[model samples]
Target: MAKFRLLPDEQLARSPFKQLWREFSRQHSAIAGLLIFSLFFLLVLLSAVLTPHDPYLQNDSLLLLPPSWSQQGLVQYPFGTDDLGRDLFSRLLVGARYTFGIAMITVMGALVMGLLLGTLAGMTKGLKSSVLNHLLDLALTIPSLLLAIIIVAILGPGLQNTTWAIMLALLPQFVHGIRNAIAEQLNQDYVIAYRLDGANNWQVFSRIILPNIWEKLTLMATMALSTATLDIAALGFLGLGAQAPTAEWGAMIADSLDLIYIAPVSVAIPGLLIFLAVLSVNLVGDGLRNAAKKRREN
Candidate 1:
């Protein structure tokens, strides 16, 4: 009798989470980015519990206090006081909340709009595609910052208006990307087979197309989040977003500009938070792309 050998267990294959973790671990920059972002996120989430004082409370006596290292120093303000004598550290924490909140809302809104438009345009041919494609091109050609400024200027500056401006600026790029991805998948044999089985368009999209395109969608969402965060900060810096005493990172930086020499920490804290937040998002995007590529190869 021939000797029988047992086949290797399929269950022993690497899990998705394991694969992702392994891939992410090899990316040092991505890991560093993740840590920095986590710190900021934690600071935001625990602001009420962690802050040394009410972020809005004014202490005129401590106004523009220099950092601990300065000669006039070792003051009660750890990161020094802003122009209004609000604790820079406390404001920085609240600023993280504002920045992250705006970014999340804008990204989510744009993702929803883009996915619907892209799906409709990609699945249909001829006139529908042509109309959408042209519209997307027109939107894409306008610089996001310029478009946002124009829209916000018309609508007047407020949180809701800023969110809308961000969505408008970001939606077109996501629409284009999703459309291209769907169009490419449409040519695959599996998609063609599904269509031939008398499956409805909605059925095919929900069951077949959406699952296959999730990776790309995730990547796009990450990029959109990063862009939205930066854009919101920029608007705040320009005095068109969040407004005064709102504890937004950009607005904090703007408020601290004149005191840069007197209290560098006031500017540094918020600026650092903004930089780390954007950097984390970008690193996460890169990691996702690398992981997806590896998955496809396997």
Candidate 2:
């Protein structure tokens, strides 16, 4: 029988994931952001059960009610009702599904497509790479939000259309960032050594380049998620996404603009949610960037 001996704590090697976690946990803002994101994610998962009232159900008598804590407010309408008498709390809860959900879907799609396209562009040279690079550069010159708007304009407004528009708008940036990162890695001496040692393109990319660029990819994905969330909300605000009767945050804000004076809380709550969502994701990204930088330095 073979006997295995456990290494002492000082001699034990931590896994890369563990090392990354250790670094990530040290950042206070990142932890806070992670907590907030977890809460939002939970809300997205449980909105149907968590909401006290149907988000789309209208109650004429309950129109524009203030928050429950207010003297005139009803306990049943906590967080109050919107101008259309829809429960603000319920709508906001469900809105997470639309906002975070769409953002997630778009980012994921963009990330996958970007990776394949970027890897292809990075691995190739001469006219093929140049053409791809120039196209991405042209796309980059157009602001992502503006590009989304143009796409949405042509595709017509709605949630599904909005998702495709945002994904398309985001694809170029993702491709550009990933391509640049891969190109940088390919230029390193280690890559040259690998090639000289008979490592093929797929082997070099899969075994070396992919591992090295993961941190950058993660950071890019986080940042892109924030942008996607904001863009979705912006499109909703402009009446180009989500549409009516949906409990989306931006549409909720748009529906209540007329009552900003009568029920400022209605507008403020959804806007606050959007702000927090964007802020939390950004804080987490910043934390990741800092952690990765420190990890690299060490």
Candidate 3:
């Protein structure tokens, strides 16, 4: 039989996140994904400073220059110039900022809001928990992407609006998952012991329930981040995300549609980056999921 093994406070205090990371290190694909994402994140952080040309700097004279390896390419523009003569390499780098930044913002916002409501729902008994659970279930009945689209459509377009829409869409998942996890925690021996000892609900919840569920919450966060990024890309592709002139991957793809035949790199570059970003994050999330499963099985 599997047993609950809550470690002593002294051991738990000494690097919990590091312990989670150690479990992650055991998975090969997860490690590869972490490396890939770390590299990509570092590149995004350095995009503005490392790239030679300004993302917004454009000229008609250098329009549609192919990548430098091609015979028609210019030596100065490594990833070539777009139809508007903007440096594709610079724009690609800059696009990462908007893509990654928006996803992070949305995920964090949703997580915080979800944690509050979910915690409240999980901690309460009888009618309150039932009501919150029903509402969450109703919300979850709507497909995430479709829900996001509906919210974005109602709120109108643009990046911030799109982000808020995505955030709203993610809230139900967090509420459902966290509520269940906390409910499970509430039934555990440690929680019962705390209650017997006259520990208040807030005391047991804050000191015990939240810490034990941190691993699950982290997994949810990574998965939500990937979803947020992909949703942003989808919305941007539809012209409902970041507006024109902004270097966002989805917006870049939209801008490149007209030049698809003439300069395929325009579309391909952004698409590939989006694919890689989504893939890496998904891999990392999968690793976290597996680790959680292993912990349970033991």
Candidate 4:
């Protein structure tokens, strides 16, 4: 008889959180993106606490003041004041809150709905799958921005409505991704073995298929976050999102467009923030996908 030694729990199952941290640290671009995102998030969370002045309050006398480091500018307005004399720095901080809020809600809503629908279609196959797939194809054929604009038009403009519009625009992408992942999972040997062991369809799907495809779904969610951020900014530029007095990044840019020549940094600040945010999300998503692939390979 061969003797076997039991492995410690730590050895048997490594900490996934630690593994994830390590993987994230290995990717320089991902680390940079994460740091930028973290800084943005800190600004958002501390906006009310750290902002030197109320973002909505206006001092007509101080309008169009250049950034603080400029020769004649004051320390109170680090990024400067907008046309309305509101603190640009404060507004930017608050804007981060709105931008992140919309992206998160829209992406999460789309992910949940897409995952449920896709899993059902993939597992069912036959006529049901064909019908669902056809519908997905139709949705994919339509321009996401156009669809979002129409949805927002009908719903009218507000933060919640904008999020819903974004979710509708992004749902099709998630649905397609989930459906393909699930379909692939169904053909795996583990699924076949589970089916042969007299496991019911629900059990096989919930236990076997869902777990296998979760990583891919996570990557899709991260990508959707980036897309939703851009979509929200576009909507704001079109005068259909976040509305006035909200201090949203997109709305800030739209409000500052007239002053672009005189105070270009006003427009540039928000645009730069948006660019960094989107780039960060994409980098993080790509890193996660690569990390997951490596883990599976190992």
Candidate 5:
């Protein structure tokens, strides 16, 4: 009998997660983005406990105070006070909960709904699929923010309404992307083999289709998350999202517009937070897409 030899660790197959990480780790910007995003997520989780003062509490005497080290600043307020004299640091910490939290929820909701609808459109025949494609095209032609604004205008402005509006506006992009991906995959040789091998639509989709298209789906998710974050901020800035006393970053910026010359830090801080959040998400998405492309080429 021939002797069998064990394969070396380097020659062994790595799990998908490990493989993706191996690819992703090579990108320095992705790692930095992940770190920044984690920091924002941590702030969201710890907002209630980490806040130095009640985000909503007002101190008329402390209005427009600068950062703690500034001549007019107080030790109790590290980032300073807003026009309402509320602790800027505290409100920003709490604001992460509203801004990032809402975007996360909206993206997830859109993803799930889009996946279902896209699958339906992809697996169906001529007329139904054509109709869906047409509808999706119409939705896509309208800018997401514009679509969201239209929805919010009809629903009446509020945080909850904003979330719903963003989710709906985002739905078309996810649906369109996923539908195209599935359509492309369906034309592959392996997909035909699966069909010939008696695999049902559900089985093919859940197994081969999903596994092959997962990278695309992930890229779409990250992009959607960034879009949702920006859309929420825009709506809030327009006074149509988070209402008064909400501590949302967009609303905070809007609230501080009048103080731009007098207490610019108040507006700048929130604007910076929004910029950082969007930038980090986009960086991670770009990194993932690059890594996935590399993996494919290899």
Candidate 6:
């Protein structure tokens, strides 16, 4: 009798979810990131119900207090107050909701826009492909942030415009990634096999090529989500994102800049939250990329 195990081909053909989970779980930093992100996002969701004070409430008499532990700080406003006495703690929590929510919406918009454009270009050949490729190449000449700023300027500054601008700016990269991924899949043996087996274009693409390229799409989506967060924050800081009265991390940071000396925590808290949000997204992206890589290597 001989002991037997599945060969690489058999293993690769097995259900992907278990393998993906196994690879993803191997990354300790990613697990830590998931926990951190969950905690913060939960705070964002629960902030409205849990806040001790209204984030927008202003009390001139209690303005610019430091953290409660600090000498001049008040106990009730544990996290402190800004130049205008808005609750730093409450605003920070609410800002998380606004910032993450906006980023998600922007990423989803970009995903759909990119996929359509990329698939159209990638699936075509000759003149049509050349035209679309040239268009995307021309669009890529300018940096995304610069393009976003220009778009915001043209569209007029506000949350909706800023979101659209960020999505538009991020679309090029996603399109490029998707186009290249599909182009590569089109050359692979599986696709050729399906084509030769009397499978129509739709059947081959929808059944084989799209499924194979899904991992790349997932990676692009995560990267797009993180990029959207940064772009939104940048726009907010420049006064082009969410308007005043909206609780957003970058906007909060801008409002608190003048009080950095009097109460640095006001600036620091929002800044840290933004940083953490980006970090968590990147960590998860890294885990997914690594997992995908591991599968490919195996």
Screening candidate 5 with a backbone cut-off below 3 angstroms (N, C-alpha, C), the clashing residue pairs are none
**lDDT tens digits, residues 1-298, model 1?**
8997644333323355465566677888878877876786686678779887899999889888777777876556677777777787778777777888678878888999999999988999898789989989998999888888888999999767888998999989989999999999889999899989998899988999898898899899988888899999999999998888899999888887987877778788788778879889899889878977776665
lDDT of 4 by residue, 165-277 (tens): 98999988989999899888888998999899999989998899877777788899988888888889888888898889888888889989998999999999999999999
**Candidate with maximal TM-score:** 5
Best by lDDT: 5
Minimal lDDT window, size 10, model 5: 8-17
Model 5 lDDT per residue over 1-298, tens place = 9997756434423566565777898999999999999998898788999998999999999888899988878898999998878999999999999999899999999999999999988889889889988999889999999999999999999999999999999999999989999999999999999999999999999998999888999999999999999999999999999999999999999999998999888899899999999999998998899888877675
lDDT for model 5, on a 0 to 1 scale? 0.91
- Which residue pairs collide, candidate 4? none
Cα lDDT, all candidates: 0.83, 0.90, 0.89, 0.86, 0.91, 0.85
Cα-based TM-score, every candidate: 0.91, 0.94, 0.91, 0.91, 0.95, 0.91
Please provide, for model 3 over 139-207, each residue's C-alpha lDDT reduced to its tens digit, 9 standing for 90 to 100: 999988889999999999998899889999999999998999998999999899999999998999899
**For each candidate, how many residue pairs have backbone atoms clashing (under 3 Å)?**
0, 0, 0, 0, 0, 0
TM-score of candidate 5 against the unseen true structure: 0.95
Q: Which stretches of candidate 1 lie over 4 Å from their true place?
A: 1-17, 69-76
Candidate 6 lDDT by residue in tens digits, 23-138: 88899998877777788778767888988899999999887878999988788888988877888888887887778877888888898899898988898899989998998999
Q: Each candidate: RMSD to true structure?
A: 2.8, 2.2, 4.8, 2.7, 1.7, 2.8
